[model samples]
Target: METEKKFEPRIVAMLCNWCSYAGADLAGVSRLQYPPNIRVIRVMCSGTVSPHHIVHAFQRGADGVLIAGCHIGDCHYIRGNYMTIKRAKFMEGLLNFAGYSPERLRLEWISAAEGVKFAEVVREFTEKIRTLGPAPSFEASPRLATAVL
Candidate 1:
Protein backbone atom coordinates (compact mmCIF):
# COMPACT_ATOMS: atom_id res chain seq x y z
CA MET A 1 0.00 0.00 0.00
CA GLU A 2 1.20 3.48 -0.82
CA THR A 3 -0.03 6.93 0.09
CA GLU A 4 -0.38 9.54 -2.61
CA LYS A 5 1.60 12.70 -2.24
CA LYS A 6 -0.23 15.97 -2.31
CA PHE A 7 0.33 18.49 -5.04
CA GLU A 8 2.71 21.26 -4.07
CA PRO A 9 2.88 24.16 -6.46
CA ARG A 10 6.24 25.62 -7.49
CA ILE A 11 5.98 29.38 -7.28
CA VAL A 12 8.44 31.99 -8.52
CA ALA A 13 8.28 35.26 -6.65
CA MET A 14 9.90 38.46 -7.89
CA LEU A 15 10.16 40.99 -5.08
CA CYS A 16 11.23 44.58 -5.29
CA ASN A 17 14.33 45.24 -3.19
CA TRP A 18 13.14 48.35 -1.43
CA CYS A 19 9.76 47.24 -0.20
CA SER A 20 8.46 43.78 -0.97
CA TYR A 21 11.83 42.13 -0.42
CA ALA A 22 12.16 43.85 2.92
CA GLY A 23 8.67 42.72 3.80
CA ALA A 24 9.61 39.13 3.01
CA ASP A 25 12.73 39.50 5.17
CA LEU A 26 10.63 40.87 7.98
CA ALA A 27 8.33 37.90 7.66
CA GLY A 28 11.32 35.68 8.23
CA VAL A 29 12.75 37.54 11.26
CA SER A 30 9.25 37.91 12.70
CA ARG A 31 8.74 34.15 12.45
CA LEU A 32 5.66 34.33 10.30
CA GLN A 33 4.89 31.11 8.48
CA TYR A 34 4.63 30.75 4.68
CA PRO A 35 4.98 27.97 2.16
CA PRO A 36 8.46 26.94 1.13
CA ASN A 37 7.39 26.44 -2.45
CA ILE A 38 8.47 29.86 -3.68
CA ARG A 39 11.82 30.60 -5.33
CA VAL A 40 12.43 34.31 -4.91
CA ILE A 41 14.19 36.69 -7.27
CA ARG A 42 15.16 40.10 -5.94
CA VAL A 43 14.81 43.02 -8.32
CA MET A 44 15.64 46.68 -7.75
CA CYS A 45 12.20 47.66 -8.90
CA SER A 46 9.11 45.73 -9.94
CA GLY A 47 8.91 47.82 -13.10
CA THR A 48 11.92 45.96 -14.41
CA VAL A 49 10.03 42.66 -14.50
CA SER A 50 9.09 42.49 -18.13
CA PRO A 51 6.44 40.21 -19.63
CA HIS A 52 9.25 38.08 -21.01
CA HIS A 53 10.33 37.23 -17.48
CA ILE A 54 6.86 36.05 -16.57
CA VAL A 55 6.60 33.81 -19.64
CA HIS A 56 10.09 32.53 -19.10
CA ALA A 57 9.26 31.48 -15.57
CA PHE A 58 6.29 29.48 -16.80
CA GLN A 59 8.32 27.80 -19.49
CA ARG A 60 10.92 26.96 -16.88
CA GLY A 61 8.61 24.96 -14.59
CA ALA A 62 7.07 27.64 -12.42
CA ASP A 63 3.45 26.85 -11.62
CA GLY A 64 2.76 30.36 -10.48
CA VAL A 65 4.43 33.78 -10.58
CA LEU A 66 4.17 36.54 -8.01
CA ILE A 67 5.36 40.10 -8.43
CA ALA A 68 5.44 42.25 -5.33
CA GLY A 69 6.40 45.86 -4.83
CA CYS A 70 5.64 49.08 -2.94
CA HIS A 71 2.10 50.32 -2.79
CA ILE A 72 0.94 53.23 -4.92
CA GLY A 73 2.61 56.51 -3.96
CA ASP A 74 5.19 54.71 -1.84
CA CYS A 75 7.58 53.45 -4.53
CA HIS A 76 11.20 54.20 -3.69
CA TYR A 77 11.95 54.80 -7.35
CA ILE A 78 9.07 57.19 -7.77
CA ARG A 79 6.25 55.59 -9.83
CA GLY A 80 8.14 52.49 -10.72
CA ASN A 81 5.33 50.36 -9.39
CA TYR A 82 2.93 52.25 -11.60
CA MET A 83 4.78 50.83 -14.57
CA THR A 84 4.65 47.47 -12.85
CA ILE A 85 0.87 47.67 -12.67
CA LYS A 86 0.54 48.44 -16.35
CA ARG A 87 2.84 45.61 -17.32
CA ALA A 88 1.03 43.27 -14.98
CA LYS A 89 -2.24 43.89 -16.78
CA PHE A 90 -0.65 43.36 -20.14
CA MET A 91 0.95 40.15 -18.94
CA GLU A 92 -2.30 38.86 -17.56
CA GLY A 93 -4.03 39.46 -20.84
CA LEU A 94 -1.18 37.84 -22.66
CA LEU A 95 -1.48 34.77 -20.49
CA ASN A 96 -5.15 34.49 -21.27
CA PHE A 97 -4.55 34.99 -24.95
CA ALA A 98 -1.92 32.30 -24.93
CA GLY A 99 -4.39 29.75 -23.55
CA TYR A 100 -3.10 29.74 -19.99
CA SER A 101 -4.96 30.79 -16.90
CA PRO A 102 -4.36 34.39 -15.94
CA GLU A 103 -5.04 33.51 -12.35
CA ARG A 104 -1.60 31.93 -12.20
CA LEU A 105 -0.13 35.44 -12.14
CA ARG A 106 -0.41 37.76 -9.16
CA LEU A 107 0.67 41.26 -8.24
CA GLU A 108 0.85 42.66 -4.74
CA TRP A 109 1.90 45.82 -3.04
CA ILE A 110 3.82 44.85 0.05
CA SER A 111 5.65 47.57 1.86
CA ALA A 112 8.76 46.84 3.92
CA ALA A 113 6.71 47.14 7.10
CA GLU A 114 4.13 44.56 6.05
CA GLY A 115 5.80 41.27 6.81
CA VAL A 116 2.66 39.61 8.03
CA LYS A 117 0.89 40.59 4.84
CA PHE A 118 3.70 39.21 2.74
CA ALA A 119 3.48 35.86 4.49
CA GLU A 120 -0.27 35.81 4.17
CA VAL A 121 -0.11 36.64 0.48
CA VAL A 122 2.34 33.83 -0.19
CA ARG A 123 0.24 31.35 1.73
CA GLU A 124 -2.91 32.32 -0.09
CA PHE A 125 -1.31 32.31 -3.53
CA THR A 126 0.24 28.92 -2.94
CA GLU A 127 -3.13 27.46 -2.12
CA LYS A 128 -4.61 28.96 -5.24
CA ILE A 129 -1.83 27.55 -7.38
CA ARG A 130 -2.21 24.14 -5.81
CA THR A 131 -5.88 24.19 -6.67
CA LEU A 132 -5.07 25.18 -10.24
CA GLY A 133 -2.81 22.16 -10.61
CA PRO A 134 0.47 22.08 -12.54
CA ALA A 135 1.55 24.57 -15.12
CA PRO A 136 0.46 23.86 -18.69
CA SER A 137 4.00 23.31 -19.86
CA PHE A 138 4.20 20.37 -17.50
CA GLU A 139 1.14 18.68 -18.91
CA ALA A 140 1.72 15.79 -21.25
CA SER A 141 -0.60 17.16 -23.89
CA PRO A 142 0.03 20.81 -23.39
CA ARG A 143 -3.68 21.23 -23.78
CA LEU A 144 -4.89 24.74 -24.30
CA ALA A 145 -7.00 26.04 -21.44
CA THR A 146 -9.65 27.04 -23.94
CA ALA A 147 -10.03 23.40 -24.93
CA VAL A 148 -11.57 22.69 -21.58
CA LEU A 149 -14.42 25.01 -22.34
Candidate 2:
Protein backbone atom coordinates (compact mmCIF):
# COMPACT_ATOMS: atom_id res chain seq x y z
CA MET A 1 0.00 0.00 0.00
CA GLU A 2 1.17 3.48 -0.82
CA THR A 3 1.18 6.11 1.93
CA GLU A 4 -0.31 9.51 1.24
CA LYS A 5 1.60 12.51 2.42
CA LYS A 6 -0.18 15.34 4.13
CA PHE A 7 -0.05 18.82 2.69
CA GLU A 8 1.76 21.52 4.63
CA PRO A 9 1.08 25.18 3.92
CA ARG A 10 3.83 27.57 2.83
CA ILE A 11 3.48 30.81 4.70
CA VAL A 12 5.51 33.99 4.19
CA ALA A 13 5.66 36.33 7.14
CA MET A 14 6.87 39.93 6.80
CA LEU A 15 7.66 41.23 10.26
CA CYS A 16 8.69 44.69 11.32
CA ASN A 17 12.14 44.69 12.88
CA TRP A 18 11.50 46.82 15.93
CA CYS A 19 8.36 45.05 17.13
CA SER A 20 6.96 42.06 15.31
CA TYR A 21 10.44 40.63 14.65
CA ALA A 22 11.30 41.09 18.29
CA GLY A 23 8.11 39.31 19.20
CA ALA A 24 9.05 36.37 16.96
CA ASP A 25 12.46 36.24 18.53
CA LEU A 26 10.96 36.27 21.97
CA ALA A 27 8.64 33.46 21.00
CA GLY A 28 11.73 31.40 20.26
CA VAL A 29 13.47 32.40 23.46
CA SER A 30 10.40 31.46 25.48
CA ARG A 31 10.39 27.99 23.93
CA LEU A 32 6.95 28.54 22.49
CA GLN A 33 6.19 26.09 19.75
CA TYR A 34 4.51 27.03 16.50
CA PRO A 35 4.16 25.45 13.10
CA PRO A 36 7.47 25.28 11.26
CA ASN A 37 5.92 26.22 7.94
CA ILE A 38 6.32 29.95 8.16
CA ARG A 39 9.30 31.76 6.54
CA VAL A 40 10.01 35.05 8.22
CA ILE A 41 11.39 38.14 6.44
CA ARG A 42 12.48 40.92 8.72
CA VAL A 43 11.73 44.44 7.48
CA MET A 44 12.64 47.79 8.92
CA CYS A 45 8.93 48.55 9.11
CA SER A 46 5.74 46.92 7.95
CA GLY A 47 5.05 50.01 5.84
CA THR A 48 7.95 49.01 3.66
CA VAL A 49 6.09 45.90 2.49
CA SER A 50 4.68 47.03 -0.81
CA PRO A 51 1.86 45.50 -2.76
CA HIS A 52 4.40 44.32 -5.32
CA HIS A 53 6.13 42.31 -2.62
CA ILE A 54 2.84 40.85 -1.42
CA VAL A 55 1.89 39.77 -4.94
CA HIS A 56 5.38 38.45 -5.55
CA ALA A 57 5.09 36.23 -2.51
CA PHE A 58 1.92 34.69 -3.88
CA GLN A 59 3.52 34.39 -7.27
CA ARG A 60 6.44 32.56 -5.72
CA GLY A 61 4.04 29.97 -4.26
CA ALA A 62 3.29 31.23 -0.79
CA ASP A 63 -0.07 29.84 0.26
CA GLY A 64 -0.47 32.69 2.69
CA VAL A 65 1.26 35.98 3.48
CA LEU A 66 1.34 37.52 6.93
CA ILE A 67 2.38 41.11 7.58
CA ALA A 68 2.89 41.85 11.23
CA GLY A 69 3.77 45.24 12.63
CA CYS A 70 3.84 47.12 15.88
CA HIS A 71 0.62 47.97 17.65
CA ILE A 72 -0.96 51.23 16.59
CA GLY A 73 0.74 54.22 18.22
CA ASP A 74 3.79 52.12 19.00
CA CYS A 75 5.62 52.00 15.68
CA HIS A 76 9.32 52.67 15.92
CA TYR A 77 9.03 54.76 12.77
CA ILE A 78 6.16 56.83 14.17
CA ARG A 79 3.64 56.38 11.37
CA GLY A 80 4.95 53.28 9.68
CA ASN A 81 2.29 50.76 10.71
CA TYR A 82 -0.39 53.20 9.74
CA MET A 83 0.77 53.04 6.14
CA THR A 84 1.04 49.28 6.39
CA ILE A 85 -2.57 48.89 7.51
CA LYS A 86 -3.80 51.11 4.74
CA ARG A 87 -1.86 49.28 2.04
CA ALA A 88 -2.84 45.86 3.34
CA LYS A 89 -6.51 46.79 3.33
CA PHE A 90 -6.20 48.14 -0.16
CA MET A 91 -4.51 44.96 -1.33
CA GLU A 92 -7.24 42.87 0.24
CA GLY A 93 -9.78 44.70 -1.83
CA LEU A 94 -7.68 44.41 -4.96
CA LEU A 95 -7.14 40.70 -4.44
CA ASN A 96 -10.83 40.15 -3.96
CA PHE A 97 -11.55 41.97 -7.18
CA ALA A 98 -8.88 40.01 -9.02
CA GLY A 99 -10.55 36.63 -8.61
CA TYR A 100 -8.16 35.77 -5.82
CA SER A 101 -9.12 34.82 -2.28
CA PRO A 102 -8.41 37.79 -0.09
CA GLU A 103 -8.31 35.47 2.91
CA ARG A 104 -4.85 34.42 1.83
CA LEU A 105 -3.41 37.65 3.10
CA ARG A 106 -3.43 38.65 6.75
CA LEU A 107 -2.28 41.74 8.61
CA GLU A 108 -1.70 41.90 12.35
CA TRP A 109 -0.32 44.25 14.96
CA ILE A 110 2.13 42.52 17.23
CA SER A 111 4.15 44.21 19.93
CA ALA A 112 7.55 43.22 21.25
CA ALA A 113 6.00 42.06 24.53
CA GLU A 114 3.48 39.78 22.87
CA GLY A 115 5.49 36.64 22.26
CA VAL A 116 2.58 34.40 23.18
CA LYS A 117 0.34 36.27 20.80
CA PHE A 118 2.89 35.87 18.04
CA ALA A 119 2.90 32.10 18.41
CA GLU A 120 -0.87 32.02 18.55
CA VAL A 121 -1.17 34.13 15.43
CA VAL A 122 1.24 31.91 13.49
CA ARG A 123 -0.61 28.78 14.54
CA GLU A 124 -3.93 30.24 13.54
CA PHE A 125 -2.67 31.59 10.24
CA THR A 126 -1.00 28.30 9.39
CA GLU A 127 -4.21 26.41 10.01
CA LYS A 128 -6.13 28.84 7.91
CA ILE A 129 -3.71 28.50 5.01
CA ARG A 130 -3.73 24.73 5.22
CA THR A 131 -7.50 24.78 4.93
CA LEU A 132 -7.24 26.98 1.85
CA GLY A 133 -4.74 24.68 0.20
CA PRO A 134 -2.49 25.83 -2.63
CA ALA A 135 -3.23 29.00 -4.50
CA PRO A 136 -3.54 29.20 -8.31
CA SER A 137 -0.35 30.12 -10.10
CA PHE A 138 0.07 33.87 -10.33
CA GLU A 139 0.56 34.01 -14.08
CA ALA A 140 -2.72 32.21 -14.62
CA SER A 141 -4.57 34.52 -12.29
CA PRO A 142 -7.08 36.92 -13.82
CA ARG A 143 -5.31 39.85 -12.21
CA LEU A 144 -2.30 39.33 -14.39
CA ALA A 145 -4.06 38.34 -17.56
CA THR A 146 -4.17 41.89 -18.79
CA ALA A 147 -0.69 42.87 -17.85
CA VAL A 148 1.87 43.63 -20.56
CA LEU A 149 4.03 40.91 -18.96
Candidate 3:
Protein backbone atom coordinates (compact mmCIF):
# COMPACT_ATOMS: atom_id res chain seq x y z
CA MET A 1 0.00 0.00 0.00
CA GLU A 2 1.10 3.50 -0.77
CA THR A 3 1.94 5.89 2.00
CA GLU A 4 -1.04 7.90 3.20
CA LYS A 5 -0.72 11.64 3.61
CA LYS A 6 -1.63 13.36 6.84
CA PHE A 7 -2.93 16.84 6.09
CA GLU A 8 -3.86 18.34 9.41
CA PRO A 9 -3.11 22.00 8.93
CA ARG A 10 -2.35 24.13 12.00
CA ILE A 11 -4.05 27.51 11.89
CA VAL A 12 -3.62 30.57 14.13
CA ALA A 13 -6.62 32.86 14.06
CA MET A 14 -6.60 36.39 15.46
CA LEU A 15 -10.09 37.61 16.35
CA CYS A 16 -11.31 41.07 17.25
CA ASN A 17 -13.01 41.55 20.61
CA TRP A 18 -16.23 43.32 19.78
CA CYS A 19 -17.57 41.28 16.89
CA SER A 20 -15.59 38.32 15.65
CA TYR A 21 -14.59 37.24 19.16
CA ALA A 22 -18.21 37.29 20.28
CA GLY A 23 -19.19 35.43 17.16
CA ALA A 24 -16.68 32.69 17.96
CA ASP A 25 -17.91 32.59 21.52
CA LEU A 26 -21.44 32.18 20.24
CA ALA A 27 -20.30 29.37 18.02
CA GLY A 28 -19.00 27.63 21.10
CA VAL A 29 -22.11 28.35 23.23
CA SER A 30 -24.48 27.29 20.47
CA ARG A 31 -22.55 24.05 20.01
CA LEU A 32 -21.92 24.82 16.39
CA GLN A 33 -19.30 22.51 14.94
CA TYR A 34 -16.20 23.35 12.97
CA PRO A 35 -12.67 22.18 12.41
CA PRO A 36 -10.51 21.69 15.50
CA ASN A 37 -7.38 22.80 13.70
CA ILE A 38 -7.85 26.44 14.51
CA ARG A 39 -6.25 28.15 17.55
CA VAL A 40 -7.68 31.55 18.36
CA ILE A 41 -5.98 34.60 19.86
CA ARG A 42 -8.34 37.34 20.94
CA VAL A 43 -7.41 40.98 20.52
CA MET A 44 -9.05 44.23 21.51
CA CYS A 45 -9.17 45.20 17.86
CA SER A 46 -7.93 43.59 14.68
CA GLY A 47 -6.05 46.78 13.93
CA THR A 48 -3.65 45.93 16.71
CA VAL A 49 -2.58 42.80 14.86
CA SER A 50 0.80 43.61 13.47
CA PRO A 51 2.63 41.92 10.63
CA HIS A 52 5.17 40.68 13.18
CA HIS A 53 2.44 38.59 14.79
CA ILE A 54 1.74 36.80 11.51
CA VAL A 55 5.45 36.27 10.94
CA HIS A 56 5.83 34.88 14.43
CA ALA A 57 3.03 32.39 13.84
CA PHE A 58 4.65 31.19 10.64
CA GLN A 59 7.95 30.88 12.39
CA ARG A 60 6.30 28.77 15.05
CA GLY A 61 5.09 26.23 12.46
CA ALA A 62 1.58 27.48 11.91
CA ASP A 63 0.37 26.40 8.48
CA GLY A 64 -1.92 29.37 8.11
CA VAL A 65 -3.12 32.55 9.75
CA LEU A 66 -6.63 33.99 9.83
CA ILE A 67 -7.48 37.55 10.85
CA ALA A 68 -11.09 38.16 11.82
CA GLY A 69 -12.54 41.52 12.64
CA CYS A 70 -15.74 43.53 12.84
CA HIS A 71 -17.62 44.49 9.70
CA ILE A 72 -16.78 47.84 8.12
CA GLY A 73 -18.22 50.70 10.13
CA ASP A 74 -18.95 48.31 12.96
CA CYS A 75 -15.70 48.68 14.83
CA HIS A 76 -15.96 49.10 18.57
CA TYR A 77 -13.02 51.48 18.47
CA ILE A 78 -14.16 53.57 15.54
CA ARG A 79 -12.15 52.86 12.37
CA GLY A 80 -10.26 50.00 13.97
CA ASN A 81 -11.58 47.51 11.46
CA TYR A 82 -10.65 49.87 8.66
CA MET A 83 -7.06 49.73 9.86
CA THR A 84 -7.38 45.98 10.04
CA ILE A 85 -8.56 45.84 6.45
CA LYS A 86 -5.66 47.90 5.28
CA ARG A 87 -3.09 45.96 7.31
CA ALA A 88 -4.45 42.66 6.01
CA LYS A 89 -3.92 43.69 2.41
CA PHE A 90 -0.43 44.87 3.17
CA MET A 91 0.34 41.62 4.92
CA GLU A 92 -1.02 39.66 1.97
CA GLY A 93 1.26 41.50 -0.39
CA LEU A 94 4.19 41.04 1.96
CA LEU A 95 3.57 37.30 2.14
CA ASN A 96 3.63 37.12 -1.63
CA PHE A 97 6.86 39.04 -1.70
CA ALA A 98 8.36 36.70 0.89
CA GLY A 99 7.75 33.73 -1.45
CA TYR A 100 4.75 32.49 0.45
CA SER A 101 1.29 31.94 -0.99
CA PRO A 102 -1.04 34.69 0.12
CA GLU A 103 -3.86 32.15 0.21
CA ARG A 104 -2.57 30.90 3.53
CA LEU A 105 -3.73 34.14 5.14
CA ARG A 106 -7.44 34.95 5.32
CA LEU A 107 -9.29 38.09 6.37
CA GLU A 108 -12.94 37.95 7.40
CA TRP A 109 -15.59 40.09 9.06
CA ILE A 110 -18.15 38.42 11.28
CA SER A 111 -20.69 40.06 13.53
CA ALA A 112 -21.55 38.82 17.02
CA ALA A 113 -24.93 37.54 15.80
CA GLU A 114 -23.44 35.37 13.05
CA GLY A 115 -22.46 32.26 14.90
CA VAL A 116 -23.21 30.05 11.93
CA LYS A 117 -21.15 32.25 9.69
CA PHE A 118 -18.24 32.09 12.11
CA ALA A 119 -18.32 28.32 12.06
CA GLU A 120 -18.55 28.27 8.30
CA VAL A 121 -15.67 30.68 7.92
CA VAL A 122 -13.44 28.59 10.15
CA ARG A 123 -14.39 25.37 8.37
CA GLU A 124 -13.79 26.88 4.95
CA PHE A 125 -10.51 28.52 5.91
CA THR A 126 -9.28 25.31 7.49
CA GLU A 127 -10.13 23.38 4.35
CA LYS A 128 -8.38 25.91 2.15
CA ILE A 129 -5.23 25.78 4.27
CA ARG A 130 -5.32 21.98 4.26
CA THR A 131 -5.34 22.04 0.48
CA LEU A 132 -2.49 24.50 0.37
CA GLY A 133 -0.38 22.09 2.40
CA PRO A 134 2.06 23.12 5.11
CA ALA A 135 3.57 26.52 4.83
CA PRO A 136 6.93 26.67 3.05
CA SER A 137 8.12 29.75 4.85
CA PHE A 138 9.07 27.68 7.83
CA GLU A 139 11.06 25.27 5.75
CA ALA A 140 12.67 28.03 3.76
CA SER A 141 13.89 29.83 6.85
CA PRO A 142 15.28 27.34 9.30
CA ARG A 143 16.87 30.11 11.29
CA LEU A 144 13.49 31.71 11.96
CA ALA A 145 12.89 29.56 14.98
CA THR A 146 16.20 30.47 16.54
CA ALA A 147 15.63 34.13 15.86
CA VAL A 148 12.10 34.09 17.21
CA LEU A 149 13.05 32.30 20.36
- Indicate which candidate wins on TM-score: 2
Q: Against the true structure, candidate 1 has what lDDT? A: 0.94
Q: Candidate 3 clash total?
A: 0
Off by over 4 Å in 1: 138-149
Q: What TM-score, computed on C-alpha atoms, does each candidate reach?
A: 0.90, 0.92, 0.89
| lDDT of each residue in 1-149, candidate 3, tens digit only | 89988889999999999999999999999999999999999999999999899989998889999999989988999898888888889989988998889898899999999999999999999989878887875565658868877
- Mind giving the per-residue lDDT tens digits that candidate 1 earns over 67-115? 9999999999899999999999988898899789999999999999999
What root-mean-square deviation over C-alphas does model 1 reach? 3.1
* Model 1 pairs whose backbones collide: none
Candidate 3, lDDT over the whole model: 0.91
lDDT of each: 0.94, 0.94, 0.91
TM-score of 3: 0.89
